[model samples]
Target: MLRKAEDVLTTTDVRRRQVDERIRRLESRLVREHDEVPPSLVHEWIERASARFGDARVRDFVPLLVERAVRASVLGFSSDQHEMSGTWLPDWARNTARRLLADELPRRWAHTAGVARRARQVARVLPVEERDLLVAAAWVHDIGYAAELADTGLHSLDGARYLLRAGLSRRVCGLVAHHSGASAVAELTGMAEGLAEFGDERGRLRDALWYADMTTSPDGHPTTVEERLAEIRRRRGPDDPVVRALAINGDERLAAVRRIHRLLRRTYKPARG
Candidate 1:
């Protein structure tokens, strides 16, 4: 009689081998589709996707589902990276930020998403390359608050350092390092030296991030600068270091916002007869 498929190998082992083969095929297809993406990066995404299903109770279709997710992620990374170099924040990066903040600090995640939305609204005013950068910065601007990265108690420096280690672009690292006048906080907290390594990426890119951050409230709603400032003070307390830094840098931050708003108004002309 012909041997059954499971006679040679246990059913579980066979299933495992099938999943592995599927993953390999998916990886090959991804490489073909996004030939420009570094092989290492592609593999990293595959590894991450595989890891996510490691503890799952079910096995059937998991590999296929993971492949679909990986494909979407790879396509997003490739498209954005090609358009903006280091400015494109991959799903991995965004997921890392969310994983760090979403459960531990849901409010922060809301604020981050709001800032990203604001970035999207103003994307037309920025160059194509900068649009992705601003959005990436918006998404991860508060990663320092994540418990894993709260070493210095200075989110800006900590977040920037983490991103730099993750092999993100210098501009994105610098923007995260010094976002929304974080330099002023660094000065107050005596972490200026640590932040200096990332340098001040001040300019339109920095200004855009600052505008996106300052105009969004803790609840993730768009608000005027005055209201946002009040919310910060209310949330952090008047004696908080962040509040002190805001007090010191309030004028400069507000000025940056006004400058960006003016640019938007000047560049955006309403359609008319």
Candidate 2:
């Protein structure tokens, strides 16, 4: 659990100077930001969040902090619900990824599509950039299966690291590397640290990614937690490395997912728009 999330905002021992630099560049007209909703719904996010979080000075960072808090809440709640639900794939993440799988591997894409759809649904709570990152991660999650890279046998880590090396955001890299931690795939391949760098440690972002990966199926679709666990049992039979690892940690992980799912659903419920 490398909890040393150094908030190294790009670079600096001089903190305020850095924030001041960004603030100085602020646009004259702040877009009166809203969640990803219709123009008609502009007031909805303000109304809802104001109702729950209440009024505070609408300072420059307040909105971002509030948004981050909302994202964290979503992750926390979703984790809990998934634990109980068993079928814990972050709904949006699973759905979007499922679709990608279907498109790439048409023969088996339907199943994968289900996974993508669920991933997408779960990702909806995130900011647009974060959501895009999640969707991209979910879609390409299984790309390691494509013969050229399967030899390493650590899809999440191996896949993500490759992309990061070429140049991708740390956030995107994080999801790709740690999503589901990919079956002890990292440990087996001695790349867990590298994978962890691509996100997926123990924070809210990691939790959200974790819940998304676990809840979705290899075949890609929503399902009950029991059914999901049963599928794992069936897929691996008994004593498979991945299966063993999942079962050993199943209780804690399931609980995490369930909590996140419940909280996120409430927090991110569609805006009035």
Instruction: Give the TM-scores of the predictions, in the order they appear.
Output: 0.66, 0.53
Superposed by TM-score, candidate 1 places the C-alpha of residue 184 at a distance from the truth, in angstroms, of 1.0
lDDT scores of the candidates, listed in order: 0.76, 0.50
lDDT of 2 by residue, 1-273 (tens): 233434454333364454444432221111112112211122233334434543344334644544544444334434432211222233444454444444566634554444454555565445554555555555656655444445466766665666566576666666666666463645654665655565455655555555655655555444445456678878887766667667556675677567656655564454221
Sequence-dependent TM-score of model 1: 0.66
Angstrom error at residue 165, model 2: 3.7
Q: What shift in Å separates residue 90 of candidate 2 from its native position after superposition? A: 16
RMSD of each: 17.9, 18.9
What lDDT tens digits, residue by residue, belong to model 1 across residues 133-152?
78888889999999899888
Residue-pair clashes, model 2: 70
lDDT minimum window of 10 residues, candidate 1? 264-273
